[model samples]
Target: MEFSNTREFARSMDKEDPLATYKDEFIFPEVNNKKVIYFTGNSLGLQPKSAKKYVDEVMDDWANLAVEGHFYAEKPWWDYHERFSEKLAKVVGAKPPEITVMNTLTVNLHLLMVSFYRPDAKRYKIICEEKAFPSDQYMIASQVKFHGFNPEDAVVEVKKRAGENHFRTEDILKKIEEIGDECALVLFGGVNYYSGQVLDMETITRAGHEIGAKVGWDLAHAVGNIELKLHEWNVDFAAWCSYKYMNSGPGNASGCFINEKYHELKEIPRFEGWWGHSKERRFLMEPEFQPEPDAHAWQISNAPILALAPYLASLDMFEKVGMPALIEKRNKIVAYLEFVLHQIDEEVESDFEIITPSNQNERGTQLSVFLHGEGKELFNYLMKNGVIIDWREPNVIRLAPAPFYCSYEDMYEFGQILKRGILKI
Candidate 1:
């Protein structure tokens, strides 16, 4: 797939793209009374046009059916979340019973840790990457402290080589072995939010299990963006938000996966709620807690129908196209974006260092660019000129060419705008 840095070439690629029609499914943001080139699906994805229709159905049910909507609504509010299990299972490569829709990302992380992060005196340490998303860092620290252990002593951070910005798989594996007997859990982000580096989850999971540690992942940035097989990888548990690549609306409900091996283990500790009880016996109001025999047991409350509706809209698109097709377009468009950026560097003599891995297998659609000079000013100039990318602290600009909606022309336009911005600075 050779790429040329020209508008005609970009338009030719777009004309040939199989996923080009998907761009119409979303509503792009307007800047300066014109549609901006959106490249921040890694942060907040553009909204699906069908989202309003889905939410309206729920609203109509509540307005007309009122209390009866719990059982009599179009989709039935009582079991709304259950509808997503099969679709989501396909997305993550798991059994339907192994996946469930529930609370927000970090909230689900804490709930899963309650069951998987059993820190005994002999094996009380946790292994994770340094500079994990701040929420994960906070959650790990709090969980360690909850067990009456100092976070500094119980949490081991695997750092990169002095000059590198991303973690090496070998280094992470060595750290897992180094912490051996004292490790209780090995938790990591499937894709680093800042550097956009995808970790080797299969190897990490196997290594953690050999060392007798429960392994989990925060897949917020990886779920819909990359191919995942949580069950096949033997991942103990995982959680992800739908707002990013999943393209659900802002602050949507999250998805969680619990390995089938843990499904029947009733003795495991969890913060239980009535919603997690067996639905067959829920109305009987039994005094004892009879947990569901699957990942559904993790639910602490009934489904948030409105929040879950938007996700259902997005999942409909995923089910129709499947992940294979989406990933194919992702690789091609990202390659074009990479080529265009390199062309810009050559033209302007800019020292733009791409911090994300060059290998396609080691990343998703995102490329994190470390700007060498006038970073903030150039970033601001791009924003003022109607390009929508994200800026991280210090000096990194993140661009994600989401396959579902982003076009090749957007990539070419971004390159042109980026060159102008750099020259202005």
Candidate 2:
């Protein structure tokens, strides 16, 4: 289907967009004296207008109530974490107890690994994507080394067949079948950070269970961008950071999920902390660790209200718009971007292809563009011209038009800037 390459066409789309009013809710960045056409929600989302008020509430509580603010503040600092779980659960399609907001991404990954990566002599290997986010790779390598296992032997890196940019779901299932017996954990990103491919989580989880392996997802790029049924998917555990499509601020809070089935299991080893203790007996200061029955049992420290507040605000917005509606809008906007980009690429016979699958169900809001020439320079040029997408090294550029705020006009503006940027090269 051909799309009109005219400003009037873009205006018409924007006029009919049900969520267009939400554009006013964000604080967009400006580059070189112009409002940036931000297509990088996959990297860092635009801040919500309410983010300031949320932070201010916490600051006000701290300033006025001192340490006693934990139980007495307007939002009640001690129960601050609880305030977010219900809304967050709705966004991710899990029950409240199955989720908890806490720590940075890699930190939570390590904590979850400690509990889930229990390997015996017969089953001691971990399977992950080959070009996973660098931090995930490092965390896995270090965790394996800490267990006295050489990463080269203990970690299995899965990749696409030769000449392919992304891995096929069939290949992943086959690999799981081949190595299931020896695999202790299958830790995969729900949507790959570089490839932007949304794996079949339900199918992947079922395959892992068939092999007696624990299935986990790192949802850093997938959380708000895609619809997830972590509980129904029977995911053993999952972790996500909220700074991306969730539209929470930079370095904002992260969340984790553990299926209710595992919540009752006493033998599942975990790294215990005071926060993970049962709420009824937590203040008793007992020497024994009595863990909570759900994902809260994974918490290691007191809640960070300053960082978490923005997510609460964003999650409320998500609840208002609803995931199904958000995803439907995202599909149309992304399709437009892809269609426009393909038009220009065809004009020049450019050596570029979108590595993210064309199937709507196989991706979220992001499109990973692979460029044939030196990709970094083109990315830099786009940046200088105020097209705010992000670059993943070695030749890929990722663009995500977050549904809540980005508009059809934003996409058109981006196309104009990108086209000019390419022609200059």
Candidate 3:
């Protein structure tokens, strides 16, 4: 499967792509009456054209049913979040009983921490990857402080080897061993946000459990972008936002997976709320709490149907095109993107070092490139010329060519645009 950087070659690939038609399903932003070649699906996914219909249904329900919408609406508002369980379970590799749709990503992570990150007198340390997404950094630090421990001591970071862009699996296991009995929680982003490196979650989880530590993942970048097996990996918990590769609109609702092993365990403490209560006893409003015997047990508030609407819309798309097809396209498309980058680098005699792992298994849809011999000007050029990508600090461009909507032609088009930018043609 040789990749050539040519319009004909790209179009030939597109013609043969099974998922190629999906590009038409999304509404892309226009630049000079032309749709932009989007690559920032890692940051925020383009709106699904069907999303408006979903939102309209919710809005219409609110208008027509008023107070009775909870029970009378077409897709009843009362148990709307329940619609996501099986579909989301398929996405995250868990049973429906272990999946729940709830608050935004960080918010869900905070609530999950209360139940999983219970640092005690002897075991108070938390092990996480170095330079984790800033939100996770803040969450871990704040959680550590709330438990009356210094974040510097209690929050241990498994760092990459000096001069390396990615954290090695051996280094991570070694850190867990070093932390040993003092470690109470081991948390990491399933896929690193910066370098676009997919961490070894199965091995990490096994190692964490060996040390009597609770394991969790912030799958913000990993969820829809990569294949995951949270339950098979024996992960204690995991959370993800729907706005990125899930294509659920900006700042939409989140999804969570809590291992069913702890479903009704009395020893495990959770910040329970009304929605998390038993569905049967919910209307009873008893004075005591009896949580749902599933992942919904962590829900702190009622379903945000409006926010979850777009998510359900996207999940419906996931159902149509299962993960296997998406991953197949993802592998080929990402390799083509990498090949294009290399071709452009050679043609323009410019330094474009992709910091992302060369191995397809260790990377998702993103190629976080070190745009050497280029600067902010190159990023600006691409954006101005109808290419949408993400720029990180210093000099890095995170180009996540989402498979569902992004095409092989986009990779070729981006390469041409980049060549022109480099040569100022």
Candidate 4:
């Protein structure tokens, strides 16, 4: 397809888009009295118009029925979280019994580690990517320290080659083999938050298992943005925030995946509570803790109905638009965005380097551009002119054109705005 930098070309592309009507489903932010071209769905998704109704239902239930709403509301507050399992299982490629919605992202990771990260003195080290998201860095370090191990000795970071912005899979696998006997856990972000690089999870998980290590993924940036087969990948466990690409509101409930094999394990180490107990006898208030034979066994408390409401609303959208449709548009829009960036770079005589992987399979919706010979002023210029984007340090901007709402014309408009800004400023 020959690409053009014209509105007509963009419009023609949008007209042919099967997901074009999805843009109307979201409520966008306005800048200078017009809707801003949003590019931060990788950070926080735009709210679905249906989110209000979901929240309102819960609010009305609480207001009218009070405590009785727990078992009597339209959706039934007690079973609200269960509604997410079937739909979310489809989203992440897991069985309904293998999935659950529970605490926030990092908190879920902490809870899951309680069961998976049991390390002996000889096999005590955890392997993760270098410069992982700071929250993960903190979580792993704190967990290591809690286990009486110095993070310096117990945490192995797989580093990228010098002068390279992205990590090579060979480097990652080699690191695992190098730490073979000492590696106790292998956890990495499925999609790197900074680079938008999709790590090879299935291969990495296989390597980790062969070395007698537990493997998991932090899918915060990957869950809704990329295709995942957690159960088939044989991932022992995984967790993700719903707010990013899931459009479940800010800091909403997170989803979890626990392979079904662990559910029947009688000797597994888990942090259990009444909510994780067998539902048949959970309300009996007995002294014994009989765990649910699935992912819900990891839950420490009951569901947060208020927070989970918006998530269920977004999951409804996912059910309507399956991952196949989402990924199709994701590849198209991201490539079109790259084309526009290169075309603009040529016109402006600017050296723009995209650090995100160019291979479709290795990258998601984000393109992290290093604006050589440009500065934060260009980023500011873009923000003040109705283009919403994320700015990282050292003059890099993350442009994540989420497939559900962002249009091709938005990309063209952004290019024009960028050209004017570059020429003027």
Candidate 1 lDDT trough over 10 residues, lowest sum: 372-381
On TM-score, the stronger of 2 and 4 is: 4
Candidate 2 clashes between residue pairs 3 or more apart in a chain or in different chains: none
How much does candidate 4 score in TM-score? 0.99
Instruction: Estimate, for each residue in 207-277, the C-alpha lDDT of model 1 and write its tens digit.
Output: 99999999999999998999999889999999999999999988889999999999889998999998999
- Residue 313, candidate 3: Cα error in Å is 0.5
Per-residue CA lDDT of model 3 for 1-425, tens digit only, reads 98788999999999999999999999999997899999999999999999999999999999988979999999998889999999999899999999999988999999999999888899999999998999999999999999999999999998998889999999999999999999999999999999999999999999999999999999999988889998899999999999999999899898999999999795578898889888889889898888888998888788988898888898899999999899999999999999999998998889888999999899999999998778999999999999998999999999999999998999999999999999993
- How well is each residue in 1-425 modelled by candidate 4, as lDDT tens digits? 78888999999999999999999999999999999999999999999999999999999999999999989999987778889889998889999999999989999999999999998989999999999999999999999999999999999999989999998999989999999989999999999988899999999999999999999999999989999999898999999999999999999888999999999985798888889988888889999888888888887798999899888888899999999999999999999999999999999998999999999999999999998888999999999999999999877899999999999999999999999999998
Model 3 misses residue 338 by how many Å?
A: 0.6
Give the TM-score of each candidate: 0.99, 0.96, 0.99, 0.99
lDDT of each: 0.94, 0.87, 0.93, 0.93
Encode model 2's per-residue lDDT on 134-247: one tens digit a residue. 999999999988988889999998888999877888988998998969999999999988878898999989999999999999999989889999988889889999999898
* Residue-level lDDT for 414 in candidate 3: 92
Q: Which candidate would rank higher by lDDT, 1 or 3? A: 1
Clashes of each: 0, 0, 0, 0
